[model samples]
Target: MTRNLLSILPVLALCLWLCTAASSRLVKRSDDLDPLEAVVSQLSQTVAGLQAEIAALKSSKADNAVLLALQTQVRSLQTITAEHKVAFLARVDVDVAANAPIPFHAVDFNVGNAYDPLSGIFTAPHSGVYLLSTQIFPQFAGDVLVDLYKNGGIIIRMRVFDSTSPTSESTSITDHANAGDKYWVQVNVGGHIYAGAHSFFSVTIVFPDS
Candidate 1:
């Protein structure tokens, strides 16, 4: 029994540490953190159940069974975290032209290769509901109007009027897209971006098609 307890002690300690680390990151409300939060919830429940089972092993000779269960649970958690993640955040640092798509050349991340930096377009890799957002910032004192296009149709529009200082406007839309469908941001009224990280775009799958 002493040897078995020693063997399982390290596994229990590692699981407890992971739970604490994951719990600390739950304060932020971000779309990208959704998957991590789900996994954390599952791990927390698993840890609780394992603790209960370990307590019951004090009077039973089920040490091998308990150790096997812990190993299986740990493997399950590893697999969950290793799944493919699809998301991207891109920003435009150069000036844009009117009636043209804003080329977000600076790609911070492109997990699924759905976003093309050369043409400033996002093609869906999977059929699902997506949450898309964009921000427009004017470099000079002028009016800036931007449109979010889904498959060549306007879905969301943002307008910013900067008379004295640089200002930005942002908006988001939750819509459905099929695989290979395109989404992009275009300049409707003005095309002059602030030329920095202030003007940006991001998209992520919220609910995949089942």
Candidate 2:
């Protein structure tokens, strides 16, 4: 039995050595690829590189598209803003602190240099269709008569009667105007108007170059 085991061990060792040498030879053969296979591998790598470049180019085109769209939108907004304007004025005085200033003065927001606080006039900044609104609130129980004038011509009149108290009366007009056209609110000489924050005059450009 011992001699049989020793002989089997020698056969096992010889088999292992042959297997290891065969594996090493196979590894070297795999490392030395044929010319055709090498060219195919190179072509595969180039194709992968080209695919990556194509993907990058597509991504760049998408980014450029988004940037162009944003630029166009910004330009449109700029044009609209340049053509639009608004002015607002409200009276805050109750009586003539000194003497009646005739026309009411500015007490609230004014934009685009459209309204003049000292003259109480809105001169058009561009040729457009304008919306003019006037609000009147009397101080005492009396009749109110005020007119909205364009270039010294009356366009709208607001008439209201508050016997015991003051109620707000408002009127508006949409008028086509040219650049430098003048607009204002006028009260009749006999009309009694109360000046307070509730009274407002406003103008807005609704359609530019209309």
Candidate 3:
């Protein structure tokens, strides 16, 4: 269809003619003009078929390039949508009494506004599978029991009791959530639960629920 493609046809013809001419001499065992002419004619038909196939391939390559570009755009849009996420990290200066909830004051990042710092609750914006993670720092060597709540129900519960030094405890879980579902963490049993910049709560949509 294009001039560039048309040009290849002539080159193929030339190569075929040369090949036939050489074959004729070897087959006929003589440079007789009549035999060589017959061989060249026979090769023309075969060369023409190859040229047509080449043209079809060139056309197909162009079409495939367009499809690849469209796929790339779709993948880019998916990545943008995946950014519906929220992460909060802070040190609670106020003492979170035992058997109470500790509301984080600092919000490191809430790109989707799903987390409310004042309320310390993360509300899902859409129905999807979400990955939730939390890290806590307990300062004293005592019984520590923390829990994560999903819609006022306990979904994740952690218990640590030791007479040693302070240590960190963390939990990660995935959940299928609906729009407006609330999730939060609370201290179940711990006298001195120290949370600081290292402590964090995060949630991200792994995939939308179908």
Best by lDDT: 1
> Which regions of candidate 1 fall more than 4 Å away from where they truly are?
1-84
Please write out the lDDT profile of model 3 over residues 71-170, one tens digit for every residue.
9999977775766544444345554666655677777667678887776788898788888888887877787888999999999998776767877788
Give a tens-digit lDDT track for model 2, residues 1-210.
Answer: 334444455555555455545555654565564543555555555545555666677788899999999999999878877768665665645442222223557457777878876777788988888888778776556676767888888788777765777677888889998989998776663245667766777787787872
For candidate 2, the lDDT comes to: 0.68
Q: Candidate 1 lDDT, tens digit per residue, 161-191?
A: 7577778899988998888899999988864
What value of lDDT does candidate 1 attain over all alpha carbons? Answer: 0.80
TM-score against native, each model:
0.60, 0.59, 0.69
1 or 2: which has the higher lDDT?
Answer: 1
Clashing pairs in 1: none
Candidates 1 and 3, the one with greater lDDT? 1
Alpha-carbon shift of residue 8 in model 1 (angstroms) = 37
**What overall lDDT goes with each candidate model?**
0.80, 0.68, 0.76
Candidate 2: segments with Cα more than 4 A from true spot: 1-42, 72-86, 92-102, 129-131, 162-164, 171-176, 205-210
Q: Name the 10 consecutive residues with the lowest summed lDDT in model 2.
A: 94-103
